[model samples]
Target: MFATRRADLVLILVALIWGSSYLSAKTATAALPVLAVLFARYAISALACGALIGLRRRPRRWTRDEVRSGSVLGITQAVVLAVETYGVAHTSAANAGLIISLTIVLTPLLDRREGRRLPPAFFVAAGLCVLAVGLLTSSTGLHAPRLGDALMLAAAVIRAGHVALVGRLTVGRPVNPLHLTTVQTVVGTALFLPLATPHLPELAHSSATTWYQLVYLALFCSVFAFLAQTWAVQGTSASRASLLLGTEPIWAVAIGISLGGERLTVWTTLGAALMIAGTYWGQAVERAHRTSTPMEESLRSCRTARADGAARRPGAVVASSPARSSSRSRGDTT
Candidate 1:
């Protein structure tokens, strides 16, 4: 139980890092181009991850399999961040944060598509999330979603796909998380390098404040958060990890309203509440499913034992009756 609680705290810290990142990202992108901010973030993160790898006595190699797997995963991650960065730039950091919570709803659907069955409550939770998103996007009016909101929604879906891919790729493989993270960050940097080249020169001339924001994003949000989450998730259920990280949108809303100078409305509040509730409900269902698996297996074993015992009962009686009659006949002759 202590281990579970500790993992929960670690995961929540991951959420906090991500939650605070919306503001940081908003600030960085306000001054620099989206690609430039992303490039700087990943470049710093890659360096940090590499340094971490070096601290190990025998760092894992980047094997062919690792390269292939990491490249796919990294590119997917790059796309997720790119969309998110651009989306946050156009939208309020609060909106970006809350809307991205759609990832929690989308992930299980992806898992279901890959042959994992979910409970009915999961559908109910998903419906609530869908309703929440709809309410959030339409709060301005009963019109089309803003460009930023749409991009964020797209990012959420992509993020879900990224999560699903990780599960699939790592299922039976001995993939080193740190090595994979390093490769992913490096690849992410490479993906954004060209797009950010135009602003690279400006990076040197930028204010210390801008550089500080970049460093914070790289070190805390990307490097530390990623590593901590990876380690924590390995020690807990995926549902538990999702539940803890799902608080990100709440933090986003809180930070945005308090610090980012965003306004709150009734609809926004309602939507936020619904989104959080749905996320928690879905996670609960998943946890229940996980916890019940062993009981289900045990029940199956018990039924099998009962069936076998019943099948042998008549045979045992017949076999015993014949032996008893033989013993009686022998006693009479004696």
Candidate 2:
């Protein structure tokens, strides 16, 4: 029970960290070009991951699958971050955070593993989220969405696709999360180096506060959150982990208001409430749909039996897999 409570707290902490990232990214970009900020965040993460691997007493060599999967995920993750950063730069942190939570609903539509149709109620919940976005984007009046909000909307869609891709690539594979993360950070560093080269001087001259934000983004938001979530989820149900992590947007709003001095007008406040409600409702619906699927239940039973039978074999080694981790990953797009 203590372990479970500890895991819950860790998950919530991760959520809080991720929630605060929009403001952090916004602050960093204010001091440096977006590309430079991206480069620094990725480079710092890569170095930190490399150091961790070096410190391991018996580090395993990277597997082919891990490299391939990490490369693909790295590119996608970079795109999501690029768009999200740009979006946050132009929008209020609260708006950015709330707008991006659309991923919670969008991912179910994008994820193809189930192959079963979602219930009608799921669509109803999705529609509510859409309405919330409309209100959020039209906070000033009923006109075109601000550039930042639109970009954030686009980010949500792309991030949903990325989450689905993570599940597709990593499920049932013996991919080490640490190795995969390292490869991703390296790929991101390489990808951004040329783009950020001209801005290196600017990045170097950034104030200590800006550097602190960059470090926070790289270490706490990316590396630490990923590791802690992975650890915490192992001790809790995917549903429970997701529930706690789902509080990210709330933290985002609270931090934006309390620390960033961002405000939400009546329309935006209503939008925020709607978004929170729609996401939780949608999440519950999707979870119920997934758990009640007969085919999925049968497949899960077969896999469990196979695993048990293999465990009884004379020379069998059960690899630590992220099959369940992928489910938790669906809701975790910063």
Candidate 3:
């Protein structure tokens, strides 16, 4: 029970870190290109994850299988984040947030593609209707979803697909979360390095202030944020964690409006309202599906149980994992 609450708290902090990041990204990208900012975050994220594994849990040895599995998860995660971060650099914070929030609606659609029938209320039709209204009403202007916006939309679909992937990657797999995280970060950073083109000359020529901004993003948003979230999700409900994070744009908007001196016009406000409504609505649908599912019917029934092990009698996730396992889109967020 205590662990569950702790995890929940961690997830909330993650939401705050991620929520505040929109402004940070806004600032960092002013001097850096979209790719450079993405590079720094992934590099720092990998470093932070590695440090956590080393400092906290002293494993006698890491198995090769573990390394491989972590790599798979990390790559997938890195791909999604890289695309989303870059996209955010191109679009308005409000639009990014509201669009990313549509991921909640995308989850059910992804399920359908996988051949599973989500409840009618998980309604692909309805979620899309709400989402279109949100997008159409955005004050940011309904310009034919720019390349950036299109990139972000892809990121959202990829992100939603990952929820299932996380479940798939983590199932029956008791790999240390830190270890798993490190591998992912490292692999992701490596994958992006080629495209990122980290120019030391460019950095050295940049002002000290820019470096400071980079550090804040690397440390607070990427490193500390990931540590807080991974720990938190282990204990809290993923759905709850996701919901909080999904609302990050609101935080972004508020931070920008209050501190950055941005305006919250009517179009943005209405669009944000619609977006938030759709996300919460999607969450409600997921929760209801969990409640109604029978344990014997499907293994995913375990999501409804408390994280600390007091799962409702049956252990749905107690399957066999390959130390061993084998292994998405992009999106931007508000």
Give me the runs in candidate 2 sitting further than 4 Å from their true place: 295-334
Candidate 1: tens digits of C-alpha lDDT, residues 65-96? 67778889999999999999999998888888
TM-score of each: 0.85, 0.88, 0.76
Taking all chains together, the TM-score of candidate 1 against the true structure is 0.85
Q: Can you tell me which runs of candidate 1 are displaced by over 4 Å?
A: 1-8, 233-241, 293-298, 305-334
Tens-digit per-residue lDDT, 1-334, candidate 3: 8777777666766776676776677777778776776777778777776666678555546766568788777777777777777777776655565677667777666654335456776675456536554463445565466766676777888887876677666667657666766777788788777877766456557677777767777788767776677667766676777766666767766776776666756666766676677667767876667655654455555543444365345755543234423211122221
Which RMSD values do the candidates have, in order? 8.2, 11.9, 13.1
Higher-TM-score candidate of 1 and 2: 2
lDDT value, residue 182 of candidate 2: 96
Each candidate: what lDDT?
A: 0.85, 0.94, 0.67
Candidate structures ordered by TM-score, highest first: 2, 1, 3
What's the true lDDT of residue 258 in model 1?
Answer: 91
- C-alpha RMSD of candidate 1: 8.2
Error of 1 at 182 (Å): 0.4
Whichever of 2 and 3 has more lDDT, that candidate is 2
Best by lDDT: 2
Q: For residues 156-213, write the lDDT of model 2, one tens digit per residue.
A: 9999999999999999999999999999999999999999999999888889999999
